[model samples]
Target: MSSPPLPLPHLALIGAGITSLTLSLRLTSLGIPHTIYEQSPSLTELGAGLGFGPNAARALEYIDPRLVEIFNQTATFVGTPSPQGKELLLQEGKAGDDKIWIEFLDGTKQPEEGEELKPEFVIRAGNNKGHAAVHRGAWLDVLGGLVDTRERVRFGKRVVDVVLPAGSKGRVKILLADGTEAEADGVVGCDGVKSKVRQVLMEALGEGREKGKCGYSGKYAYRCLVPWGKAVEAVGEDRAGVSSLWMGPNRHLLTFPVDKQDEKFLNLVAFVTDESQVWPERGPASLTLPATKADALGDFEQAGFSDSVLQLLKVTNEKMDKWGLYDVADRPLSKFYSGRIMVIGDAAHASTPHHGSGAGFCMEDIAVLGALFEEAIARQRLTVDALEDVFAAFDNQRRERDQWLVNSSRRAADLYQWRIPEFLKPNSLEKMKADIEQRQEFCWGFNVGAAVREAKKHMSERLAAYK
Candidate 1:
C-alpha cells in the first residue's frame, strides 16, 4: 500500500500591516503555505515616524536576520556609525555622550536670563538602548516589495467573518466582503486597531460587547514631515538630527529624522489632550480631520513652547489634518485565542504610541508565533487542535507583556504631559526621571529568546498530552 500522504499546513493572515508582513516572511522562510488578505486595493501605511526599540530589533533577529536588514536599510540613525554597521545599536558600555536616543526638555517654561536651555534628562544609546525610525509608508513599501508577489497576497478581500471548524481536521472558512470564501487550517488576525476579526473572536468567546472596540484615548496629534534642510534651519541641526521630546501641560511634541526616497526629513508629532470635547464617534476612515497651521499654533499658543517647536509646526502644509489617537486600553482583552483563530499585533493589544514600542512589541508577537508554528510543524502537529495548542501557548507567553504595554503607554503619555498627579510637585523631576528609566529598561530588556523557547516548550507539552 502507498504511504500515507504528508499533512499540509496553511494559514490565513488578515491585514497587510508590518506584523502580518513580518509573519509572512517567516512563514515563507519555513515553507509554510499561507495567503495574506488585505482590505485595501494596495498595501499602504499611515502615520509618520515609527521606531523600534532594542527588544523589537532582537525579535526581528530571532525571526530572521533579513528582517533586521530590511529595517536597517530603511531606518535613519542619529549620531555616528551608519545604518550599514551595527555599532550604534543596543549595546552595553557603548553609549557615549554623543549617542543620544531622546532628549527630554520642558516646554512649559522658558529658560531664566543667561541660562542656556538644557534637557531635563536624556536616554542614551546603550544597555538595550536603540532607536531607529522611518517613515511608516516607506518602510511598509519596502517590506511589501519583499513579501507581496501578487500571488501570495490578495487585495481588496475584507474578512467579514471567520467560521471555525467543528472537527480537528476540518478547515476554517473565511467569509469575505466581496461575496467570496476561502478555507485554511488556521487564521491569524492582524487586522489592526479596528479589527473585524477581534470582534468575531470576542463574540465567539462570549466576551463583553465592548471588549473589541477601540477607545478614543482622549488625545489627538498634528503630524507632518518637513524637509531636513528646513528642519535644520528651523530647529538647528542638532535638534533636527537627534530625537527630542518637548514636554508641557496638556500637550507635548516630538521630533526625529526619517528618510523619504533620497531626501531626509524630520518627522514631527504634536499631541494635545482635549478635555473640552469628547472625541466624536466616526467610522474607520482616516481617523483624522482637517486643520490649519493657525489651528495647530493656536492649540500651543499658551503652552509656552520654545521658538523651535513653533517653527517646526509652521513649516507644515498650510492645510493639515490632525489624527485622533485611539487604543484598546478602555477594554483590554484577557484572551487572545478562540478555537484555531488568534489575534496578533494591534488586533490583540493595541496601545497608545507614547511608548513608541507598539510595532516593536508586535514584532515580538510575530516571533513567538513563528516559533510555535515551527515547533508544531516540526512535530507533525498539523491538526486543528494542535494549532489551537500553539495559539494557547502564544497567549500564555505574550498576554502579560503586551497588555502591560497598553497600560504603561498611557502612563508614559501622562508623564510626558506632566499630568501624573504624583509627579506634579516641585523636585519631582528626579522621580519622573527614575520612572522613565525603569519603564524604558523594562520594555527594552524583554527576553524574546526566552519567550520563544518557553512558548515552543509549552506547545510541545500540549501536543504530547493531546496524543
Candidate 2:
C-alpha cells in the first residue's frame, strides 16, 4: 500500500496531564506533530486515586487497545469476576464476597450490637465488572513515561496567553510565563481546572476571564491512601477489599483499593458539605488546610458512622488536609472553542467527584479529537479553516454530553448526601435507589464509537462547506 498522508496542522497541547498524555499517544500513533506544555518543573501528579467506569475504559480501547492494557496492568479491579473480559456478568453478592460496583449504606444509623449491617442498595458493576482504579501518581507516571521525552514534552513552560489567529491562514501564538512565544496551527487546552489557556480562550470569545474560573461546589473532602493491610486489620478483609459508599446527611465517604507493583492501598475520600463557609482562595495553605484527627473523627461521629468506618478514618494521618472540590458548573462556556484554540478535559468541564467519571470523560474527549484529526489528515485539509472546522465539529458533538456530566455530578452529590427534597417524602429509599441505578447505567452506557462516527460525519460536512 502507498504511504499515508503526513499529519497536518502542527498542534500545541497545553498541560501534561492525563488528557495531554492520552491525546499524545493517539497523535503519535497517527504520526501527528505536537508538544505538551506543563507549568510544573517535572512530571508528577498529586492525588490519592483515580477511578474509571466501563465507559471510560471503552474510550481508552477506542483510542488504542494498548491504553486499556496499560491501565489493566497498573489498576486495581474491585469485585470483578473476570478482569480481562468484554462482558459484565451481574450477580448477587455472597457472604464474605461482594460482586458490585458500590454497596451504599445508611451512614446516619449504626447497627445494633451483634447485628450485621445491610446495604441500603447496591449498584452492580458495568461491563466486565471491572471497576478499574489506581493511584493518580502511579498512572500518571505510566502515561507520562509513554509520551514524555525532552523533545516532546516541555516543562516549566506555563501558558500565559493564547493569541488566536487573526485570519484563517495565520498561526495561533502562545505566550509562556517565562516570556517566550510558540506558534502552532491550533492549540488544545488539556490543562486542569485552573487552566490559563481556558482563561485566554474565554477572553477571546468575549466572555470575561471570570467565565473560565472553576466554582466551589460547597463540598470539601479529606483524602488519604491507607495501607491495604491496615484497612483489612481495621475492618474485615471482606468489607475492606470491596468498594463501598457510606451515605449520610450532608456527607458521604467512599473507599476502594488501588494495587500497584510495590504496594496495595485503600483510597478513601470523606466528603462534607458546609454551605455556610465560604471557600478560601486557591493557594497551598487554602487548598490543604491542616485539621486534627479529632476534627475528622468529630465529623463522622455525629453522622453515626460505625466503628469500622471511623477506624478507617483514624488510620489516616494524625493531621489531615481538607481539600475543597471545585468544578465549572457555575460558569460553563457558551462555546468550547474560539478560533483555533479549543479547551478539552478538565479545562472544558471540570466536575465534582460524586460521579467518579471525570477522568473517563477526559479519555472520551481524546478519543473524539483523535478521530477528527485522523479524518483531517486523510482529507489533507491543512489550512486554519479546516482546523476550525474540526474544532467546531468537536464542540457541536461533545459539548452537550460533557456539560451534562458537570450538572449530573452536582445532582449526584445531593442524592448521596440526602440533601435532595425528594428524600423527605415517602418512599424516599425507593426514589434514591431508582435515581442512582438510572444514573450509573447512563454514565457507563455511553457509546464512544457511535460518537466518533457522528463527529466524523459532522466534520466532513463542515469541511465541505469551506471547499
> What are the TM-scores, per candidate, against the unseen true structure?
0.93, 0.93
Model 2, 1-467: lDDT tens digits are 97665446689999998888889999889787898888889887765888887778778876877776777666777777454332342121111222588889887666777787678888876434346687888888888778745789889998888888666778889899899999988999998887777788788878888777887888888888888888888766877777889998788999988886779888889998866656776672145666766887888888777776787788887877888788898889888898889999999998988889999899889889888877776677755567778888789878898899999999998889888886768768878888887887677777777878877777677666776
| Candidate 2, position 467, lDDT | 62
Between which residue pairs do clashes occur in model 2? Answer: none
Instruction: For model 2, state the Cα shift of residue 16 in Å.
Output: 0.5
- Tens-place lDDT digits, model 1, residues 1-467: 96563565688999999889988988888778899999999988875778777788778887878777777776776543454235445343344324677889887656675565578888765543667777799878877888854978899999888998776668899999999999988999999988888888887789844567777888888888888888888767877878889999989999888887788888888999887546765665457888898888988877777765787788887887887888888787778988889899999998889888999999999889888888887777755557778888889989899999999998898899988899999999988888887888788778788888887788788888886
- Minimal lDDT window, size 10, model 1: 88-97
Report lDDT (CA) for all predictions.
Answer: 0.81, 0.80
Query: What's the residue-level lDDT of 21 in candidate 2?
Result: 89
Those runs of model 2 whose alpha carbons end farther than 4 Å from true positions after fitting are: 1-7, 84-98, 126-129, 282-286
